[model samples]
Target chain A: MTLLEIMVVGVLGLAGVGMYGLLISRNLIKIVVSLQVLVKGAMLALIAAGYASGHINLAQSMAVTVIVADTVVAVIGLALAIQVRRRFGTLDVKELATLQK
Target chain B: MLNAILVVGAVVGALQAIRAKRLLVSALWLAGCSAMVSILFYAMDAREMAVIELSVGAGLVTVLFVFAISIAGEDTSDVRAFVPKPLAWLLVLISIGLLGWMIIPTIGAPIPGVEPSFSEILWQQRGLDVIVQSGLMFAGIVGLLGLLADAKVPAKETAAQKQAATSIPPPPKALSQSPAIREEAHV
Candidate 1:
């Protein structure tokens, strides 16, 4: 296989693993970390796809949008984490299971 | 040379996020990983991607993480003993399987081209992705609202406090008190 394809595949594979890990984790912080993996994976995929299209502006544009949106999302996540800590005193998702409302 | 540096950095960042004791340190490590990944993008000739990752992944995300760490302080859990044995083994096995699957299929696909216009596909061809991205943004907003409400401390002793507050009589006027004072003096 070509070296380029190998990198794309590695990015995709690891990104999926990172996302899956994020989904199953009981810790809120780990979940966020997993989300980082997923975001990175998506970014890589966009870049890989762009590279595939060869000099297309459309793919590049999408990658730019993804990065900006990622920053916005991460900011919102931080806000939520702050709120969670204030109310729960911990970042454990397991505590959420016991919550009534 | 740059790729090697980025790859090594990625490994170190991953380890820090995984093994670091403090959530602050872990968040910082994740941001570092994001920076390395962005550098990798630049090396791969994805300039726009590198720009976005640096801004969002490392810049905005790290700020959010800092806010979280400030809110959370330190976690005193046994840092070393996290992730049970079964789970760790499962993660390892699953990772191996996934790597194998991804590499195998990629062996036959056409090599990627360096296109500068991937955004065209999203807006022009795959318009649905925009809708999905918007939906995701909306969902996150809703989640934030939920967090705000969740963080609120419920007022304690509500019914009794309200009842007592409502039942209490207004204080006697000074004019009314003067007569009572004179009567007591006379007695």
Candidate 2:
């Protein structure tokens, strides 16, 4: 397979794995992890497509923006998750759903 | 050969991360996956992206996950019924297979575009985007500071801390003490 093909397969596989994680995981941290995995797959695809199309700079800049946004989102999400855990006393979604207030 | 290895390694690491029992273990595996992805980006001749992925995805994201896990410390009870495992696996396989099948034919297809230097494209065409992105990052930093601000800093300072705080002269007065005093006084 060509490098592009390999990357495409890798991206798709990573997305699939991330989705599986998202569906099955109960822990909030794991959920975040799964989401990151999914985002990484999308970033990979973006750069790979850019490379193939000969617009490397456009892709790089876009990827940088994405990385920054991703970091911010992750930080904010973790902070929120920590707050949830502190208030609810558990990270499990099932427990969280049943938690009053 | 190296490309295939990196891709497989990344995919395996991601799978392991999703499957690992302990949250910490899962997070570390995610880091490993990110490292592999960075390597793949490097191999694809996107060196800048590789470094960014290494620093942000592997480094910063992992640290954030660890900190969150530490704060949310608890043994998560495994839920067997959250989603049916077999169905999930089947969906994963099918989706991957379908996407791979669709994209493989597009490999090596030539794309037509006005080929400008990457630097020019970044600085000229997308300059505004870069500025906005910088603003976004700054906003993110400010928002995070607000979100994680510790409320326990005490509206009422302890006497010793208050004394320490007051004992320190204002910047203008402190600056005046330098010429040491002269150099300080200018500020």
Show pairs that collide, candidate 2. Answer: B178-B181, B178-B182, B179-B182
Q: How much DockQ does model 1 earn?
A: 0.32
Measured with C-alpha atoms, the lDDT of residue B68 in candidate 2 is 82
User: CA shift at B147, candidate 2, in angstroms?
Assistant: 2.7
Off by over 4 Å in 1: A1-26, A52-80, B79-83, B107-119, B122-128, B131-146, B149-187
Task: Give the CAPRI class of candidate 1.
Answer: acceptable
Cα miss at B51, model 2 (Å)? 0.9
Q: How many angstroms is residue B156 displaced in model 2 relative to the true structure, after the best TM-score fit?
A: 15
Candidate 2 docking classification: medium
Residue range B1-187, candidate 2, lDDT tens digits: 8899999999899999988889899899999999999998888888989998999899989998888888788555777748799988888788878877876677675587786766787688888987988898888888778767655554776899888887965677755666677866578
Report, to 2 decimal places, the DockQ of model 2.
0.57
- DockQ by candidate, in order: 0.32, 0.57
